[model samples]
Target: MKDYYEGESAVFPLFLVTSSDGAAWSRAMAWLFPTLLLQALLIVSFLHLIWDWFQKQSFNKQMFVLVWMRTVLGGLAAISPSVGSLEGMVFMISEVTLSIHMYVLFEIFLQSIVQAGIFLWLAKRFLILQRK
Candidate 1:
């Protein structure tokens, strides 16, 4: 038989071996490592924030509310779309995750804001402000 890739006179190989997948794996690793690091850092940072809030006796409730909506709920939303096989849902979750991640990155700014409706500050020992 003739191979379509070559002229009709060319014969196809008895066994085909290709390096395309090797190239693809290399490309995948290029981004995969960095993505893993980023995801780990994001998880750590958000976990630290939640831990801080839990330990704190005083903070802006409104700030926490906004943060909760953006980080916690957004994280949940991101997770929800991923477990399903709906078309385009992963893309949508990715977009949402990207936006929420940005917000989470700037959470300290939210932390600095004044709570509008109600403020909670009932600490006695000491307050620790983590700076990134």
Candidate 2:
């Protein structure tokens, strides 16, 4: 009954908190903030494209297609399993949006090209008529 636990000893690992070397938590926050910001930007830009398209009342058919496609893609993204898997879906969304943006830009460009070509052709014809 005197001292059965007298010689018992216990050792626990000690965690040292140091300021000169930043903690793992701060480094993680630094990396995470930028990635989250980029994702946010992608979403914002896609939404802006949609708003602009609707505002213009142009490309009715293409706009409908884009609207439906984005709706489905966004739904899928919402239900996706986790961030890792959803990252690919986000890329897919970005690709689709960019493709639409490029198509819209190209339409404007090609229209200008066609208009210029027709104008020049008409000018050449006028010159021929004047020469005759």
Candidate 3:
């Protein structure tokens, strides 16, 4: 077992055995497996939400437009810092804390926006199809 580090702080523990041959593969799998699993779960949940919304026959065009705007603006705001840094541009902006906590919050926010958009869009499309 070894501790992975970024800068001076120990980040996470890496469990390793005597065998070096399979170490790289194991490490890759450790990261990839959980990511793939979570993505699959999210997709399944989002689809379920869409189905539920359709079954309930709840579709609002006004709300869809509002959510679309929110999602687009929120996504742009989240990526602005990275984009500005990469472009060597600076604008008057309040300092935002960058930490694990902030990262998790941003991820949750983005995921909600995505799920909401998907749900509303599918519901609207299905409602239209039913009408025609």
Candidate 4:
């Protein structure tokens, strides 16, 4: 393989942003595409699994809430930028599909870490209400 430390290769979007010096950008591009593809695949696969689960299981409030949240998060992710540049103007470099995949993963991660307690409390309340 050719050395990735060479030139300012074009990003997929072609006009999002390019490094003037070609140092950090070059390294990032080397690993960026493949990683993005893998990430997309994983996200899509997980979404498909969730869909399948929905199809097989009987409908319930808890499942409904979980699936609804996932759907909304996935929708947000679908519009996410794989990488953005703030140099002068905002630009998105990643494809929509890849962007969404990555965003979903990130959103879920943040939700888990940042709102774990709140989510647990809400889930408990929801369960209690559902029992009545």
TM-score against native, each model: 0.30, 0.26, 0.32, 0.28
Ranked candidates, highest TM-score first: 3, 1, 4, 2
Q: Which ten residues in a row have the lowest lDDT in candidate 4?
A: 81-90
Mind giving the per-residue lDDT tens digits that candidate 2 earns over 1-132? 112112222111112122223675477567787986785567447646775554454444444444443343433344553121344335433323444334433454454445334534554587699999
lDDT of 2 at 101: 34
Residue 8 lDDT (model 2) = 29
Looking at model 1, report the run of 10 residues with the lowest lDDT sum: 10-19
Residue lDDT tens for model 1, 22-125: 77557766888899678656744765687665545344554565455544444434444331212223443342344443443355334434321122331212
> In model 2, what is the error at residue 103, expressed in angstroms?
41
Which parts of model 2 are misplaced by more than 4 Å?
Answer: 1-23, 53-80, 83-132
Better structure of 1 and 2 per TM-score: 1
List, residue by residue over 1-132, the lDDT tens digit for candidate 3. Answer: 122222233332222232233786577767887986786576556556665554554345434543443444434344454321311124312232234324534564566567666756775798799999
Which portions of model 1 show Cα errors greater than 4 Å?
A: 1-20, 53-76, 79-132
